[model samples]
Target chain A: MWLRLNLRHRIYAILTALVIITISGGLVMVWYTYRMERLFSGIIGRDLVGFQVAAALEASLVHQKGFVSYYYLDGDPEWLRRLGEYRQIFKERLREAEILSDTPRQQEILESIRSEYNEYIQIKDRVIDYYKTGQRKALADVHPQLRELFFHIVDQCEVYKHIFTDQIQEARAEAHDQAEQLRYVAGAAILLELLLALFLAFVLVSHILGPVRRLTLAAEGGEGPGRIDNEITALSRSVRGLIQDAGQVHLELERSREHLLQSEKMALVGKLAAGTAHSIRNPLTSVKMRLFSLGRSLVLSDTQKEDFEVISQEIRHIDTIVQNFLEFSRPPKLQFQEISPSTVVDMALQLLSHRLDAYDATVTLQRSNPLPTISGDPEQLKEVLVNLIVNACEAMGRGGAIVIREETAVLPRVGKAAVIHLSDNGPGMSEAVAAKAVQPFFTTKDEGTGLGLSIALRILEEHEGTLNIQSAEGEGATFTIALPVKGADT
Target chain B: MKTGFDILITDHNPHVRRFIAREMTAAGYRVQEAECGADVLFQVSGNKAVDLLILDPDLPDIDSAVLLQRLRKRTPALPVVIHAFSSDMEDHPEYLKSDRFVEKRGASIEHLKEVIQDLLIRR
Candidate 1:
């Protein structure tokens, strides 16, 4: 249950417990010391004074004993006067002892001592009177009795002194017992404090420091030693890194989702377009045949002939569009053959020679060396080349010069590849158009099917190749084609 | 005025078949029409000497690949002209195994006539 608390709460609980123990233990020690101080004051200020007064009373009683005897012997009335003075002193000391008395037992003993001393004094005074009256027999008998009273009073005073002494002894003993109790309590508090300290250390080490060390290691990917002094600092750095990585992953996932949605939409459109194109093919073919037969059979004026030719040309254009849709929707099976890329290039130029002448475009093939042989569909490659050339020609409109450069290079991730760079000396495309040039159905031309570059890219991808378009407004466009060499492991 | 060569024209569309048959008949060859795979097979199995077979790959009754395979097995020496869209021919290159491929287009009749003349002369 203790382990379930988080680092902050765990430290808080331990610190709180430690503080409570320390404060309560300190308070108990303080209270014990105060009690001890009060006990010592009581013993010194009251008990010790009471004991001293009791002794003084005993001394005065003894002094009067000898003074009364001296009066009996010398007959000097000055001795009698000194005896009265000692009596006064003894009475004053008894009063002081009574006032100092604290417990009921000590007060009672003092009262008994006062009564006995009074009795003793009265008997002694009687003896003095007998002496003064010159009654020798009576004086001797009373003197003996007086001597016994004096001894009894002195014994009572001794008992009163013992009472105060006993109180002092009791106070000392009580203080000792309290000090012993305080010792035990202090020892227990110290032991408890030690245990709490150890527990706090244990919690900090195992629960906090251990995990933080491990977290720092994991966050650093076990790459480096502890460079940061503070563990939390390193952890925060790692957390920042992880957060950044998570953000990038989220962005990538969003992009992929959008791309998937776009591909699915294109796939759906392709399916619909293919179906429509296939259905239209048969009827379109019948119309073509009828037109063919009509033109061949009928005799017509030049205007009629021109109209007929225009209609036929429009029908052919529609057919071409339908064919493009079908081709885009259903990719043809590639016929891979071992051939040099230069061969395909030559074929494309030969095929497009008449179109080039019509468009007034000149092509210069930079055949430094025949391109490396690769396994690909030559017909599809030729088609792509022809399409690019035709587009370049149309862009230039007239007097366009196209340069075809071919080479072999080792491309990263594609290994050895046959690279073809077809650059046209014509007005290039804007960045936006260039970026979307390979997208299906994205076209700048009015009469374009817009599947040319898309189909070219698709065909290149099937051959494990790439098509890259580099163009800027007012600058000529450069189309780079890279086809991986056969048997080259990337 | 019919020539010695007998031609079989197969297509799912009746109008296309009718026109091609008309064109071929006018060109002095005896032409027969088959609208479906079954009809084409039935006509080919008949005793009539079909010197040539111009077949559209897309038919109603059977899979084109299977029909082409069957036709190749039934008449190994017969020259079959695949008269279909170029896109269709590209999709199924096995159709290229036929004697000739003539894309059905506006000016395709001249190409088709030339192919037929070449095939009959070779036969």
Candidate 2:
């Protein structure tokens, strides 16, 4: 379920869980704290107050006894005043004790304490009166009873004191028990919250950060193979695909950059050729005319006529070079037509059969009975094929087999196209020569015009095709011309 | 046919102009030379006896097409021939007005002479 949800929904659900846990935990803590505070105040305030009141009543009763004893022994009037003061204090204490009683047994204990305390106060007064009238014997006889009454008051007060002390102890024990229970509940709640938070953190880190880290690793080209996590592996795969796409785009850009530079270089060559042709062609015309005039006017030996013929021939050669230069600089318009690619190849092969026989070279062709028809200029395409075949034949001066094949091929970005493969088992070209083979005026052969491949390349370009050469030293050379299949683009 | 009728040959190159003039002289026609368009206009308007004009389209002083247009207005009845650097000139009105268009190096001097004789015979 978590995997099915996208990142946004998962985050929302997790955060909501965290919020609820936090709020409920806070409420539990607050409620527990309030209960604990009330328990704490009850234990300290009420229990301690009961203990203090019982202690005060015991001290007052003891003081009254001491005052009566002093008056019997020394008969001082100050003892009488002290005894009255203690008696007033004992009454005040008894009144406070009565008000503090809550339970029925505690109320009964307070009533017995009130009665015993009043009897003690009455016995102390009788002793005080006997002391004041100078009845020493009577006071002596009352002193023992006063002593018994004081002890009785002490006993009841001790009972009342025990009750307050017992209450204080019980309240403390109960408060401790409640506090212990609250500690367990609060501790459990806190532990649950902590566990929940840790779980949430684990989920958040593993789900969110793990995939992101894997994605980063993939982007950095550092992802290891055989990833286990489904989500992270998928993210890594996507990143890898993106990288591959970027790499393909980069390769295409590099190809276009090289193509553009080649075009610019060709443009420069055209301008230079045009200027040079213009300057030299006019002079060549004059030379031809002058040579003809000399031939017509001079009466000379065979040697002189031969020399004039040689001169005319050399002049014609220069004229041919100039004409070829102009032609390269300014290409003739293509006469486009729809023709069978194989038919054109066959026509060029048939034209070259006589030449192949002369070179003692054998030729072979793939049986393409009815190849797809493509739009092209048959004459120009034939010229391109013938040039390539002648080049192959020349490379194999010692004689070799020439093979031509055709197929439907698919190119990168550009779709299906027609391909003609012409392979020659001859002396293969070096990498340097292969690199610059199609550049104008670059030739390796002694008598080559150096414009054949360049011209062929130009013609193929007009048909939106390319000449691809593959060669290595001591191996064979293969030239593949890839032309677009159907909708022709000039 | 007249034996020594005068003809004008105009070209920037001295060799081509002189060569053609020599070829026409051998054919028994009086040949005059002009180096520039102004010279052709000057010689044509000055000499009423000039029988023909052979013009090269590339000239030093003036555009050959402009010169031809101006010269045609001045000498309407004179037969004109264009010696071109390229063969395809069916598109130009000025060139089509000429009685003959021969590509300079494309045609032999013998072919140019044959054209000259044919045009003079017609005249």
Candidate 3:
């Protein structure tokens, strides 16, 4: 869930958590230290007060004994004054013990110490007064009682000191245990802070830094050192899609460029053909005239006559090829008319009838009836038909049946149209040859001008029609001419 | 048509010139062949008194149009026929003053013979 947060929010959240953990750890340490300090201070303070009261009471008892000795031995007035000061110190020490006692047992012990000191002080005073009257026997008997009272007070002070010492020991042990616990807590707090810092670093690396690095690599086309994640994967897929789209556009551009080059080639061929035909025509005409004159002037045997006839025939064939080239260079301007496609087809067939028969090829004109009149140049249409039929015949060198069919069909990029199919049962062409078949000046036959289909395709294109062919190796070829119908869009 | 009138033929192709010379010579006209523009000028300035000039526009040595203009200045009344290839046979207005033009194509030789016979008969 935290990983889904955006980078900024994730960083901010981790920082906040780290801060809170640090502050809470510090607070826990402070609270533990304060509680331990208060408990240790309470225990040790009561014991120190008890020890002070015991020491003061012991000093007071020793001073009282010394003062009584001085007064009995010298009977000096200064000794009496010092005796009073000792008496006052003893009373103050007892008062301190009374105030220091809190528990009922200690309070009761302190009350006994107070009463014993009071009785000893009163007996010492009566003995001092008898001494002043010169009765030493009274002094001697009371002194023993005073000395016993001082011994009892001494025992009480020793008992309170022992209690204070034991309590102080207990306080020291308790404070030591608490100090050990606080040290452990402070150590745990530091460890917890370290863990928090480490966790934030992990989040920054995995959630923020790692993903950002991956994103950078994805942007730079996966060339960097980063692993793939979903966003990067998706970005790469789209980039690939864009590249593929550009590739397709480049392919289309290359195809269009090829077409432009082919057209340019055709234009060059036109210029070349025009120049070449005229150059060759002059000598050809001269040769024909000379041959005519020679033939008229001389008589020849039957064999020589036959040879002359062959030469004349070959010369005529050359002339025809030259004429064909001239025609290719200058196609006739189209004269559009509504003409029956069947008429043009039949006309071409009749013209090639002899050649067809010589090849022993049978042509089946399916539905030899009148097709719907299409708007096109009849003479040009006839020429297109003648060229295609002649090509079909040439393809079927030995003999093969050709099927000619006509019908209304829908063509791609054009509407409903009239389609003519001229199929030959001869050896078909490979896909490569079939593709370049309509390109001008592309020829397979040694004697081919390669202009037949090229001119036909140009003429058909002038009428906004298309010539398409389909063939596979070893099978026959099918040449299809699709012309838009009368009312159909070109 | 004419027994022995002087005529000049100018062309770069020697074979074409030979053929035309032979045909015109057989027809009884005194025929002379020049292979270039300089040859035309050389033959025309001589005492041959050329009656007609048949020229092909493609010349080896100097521009043919310039030679034709110079030839016209030298022999203004000499009937001139341009026997040119079809592609170069542009009927420019400046060249229309030539007596005739015969495009080298089908029936061009026959037409040239007729033009020559007519020009000779008129001469």
Model number with the top TM-score:
1
Best by DockQ: 1
Can you write out model 3's per-residue Cα lDDT over A456-487, one digit (the tens) per residue? 99998887888899999999899988887777
For candidate 1, report its TM-score: 0.85
DockQ of each: 0.74, 0.32, 0.19
Mind giving the per-residue lDDT tens digits that candidate 1 earns over A1-490? 8767787898899899989989998899889879988998988888788778888989988888787668778989899889889989998998888777777887887888788777877777777777788888988778777777778778878888888788899998998898898889889888988998998999888988879878888989988575658888888888899999999999999998997897787788789879989899889989988898898889999999999989988888888888888888987688899999999999999999899999888888888889889999999999999999999998988899999999988988578999999999889999999989988888999889888998898889889899999999888999999999987665
Off by over 4 Å in 2: A1-236, A297-310, A346-367, A397-414, A474-476, A487-490, B38-49, B60-78, B87-99
Model 2, span A1-490: residue lDDT tens:
8789887787778678768867876887788778868876876677677778889988987776566667667877797787778878988987887788777877887788787767766766776677677798887887778777768768878887888788768867877897788678768767877876787778778878776766656564655545446656566676778889999999999999998999898888988988899888877888777776676669989998788778777777778778777878887578888787899988998898899998889888886564567788999999999989988988998578999988877886345778899999998989999988999999897655577888899999989888899999889999999888886352
DockQ of 3: 0.19
* Candidate 2 chain A worst ten-residue window by lDDT: A220-229
Model 3 residue runs over 4 Å out of place are A1-237, A257-289, A315-382, A394-420, A424-447, A454-466, A472-475, A482-490, B1-7, B37-53, B61-84, B90-111, B118-123
The best candidate in terms of lDDT: 1
Candidate 1 ranges beyond 4 A from true positions: A1-12, A63-82, A102-104, A126-147, A335-379, A401-422, A463-466, A480-490, B1-6, B46-52, B72-79, B90-100, B110-123
Better DockQ candidate (2, 3)? 2
What lDDT does model 1 reach? Answer: 0.86
Docking class of 1: medium
Q: What is the TM-score of chain A alone in each candidate?
A: 0.84, 0.59, 0.52
Local accuracy of candidate 1 as per-residue lDDT tens digits, B37-99: 999888888888598999997998898888888988998888889888766666577666554
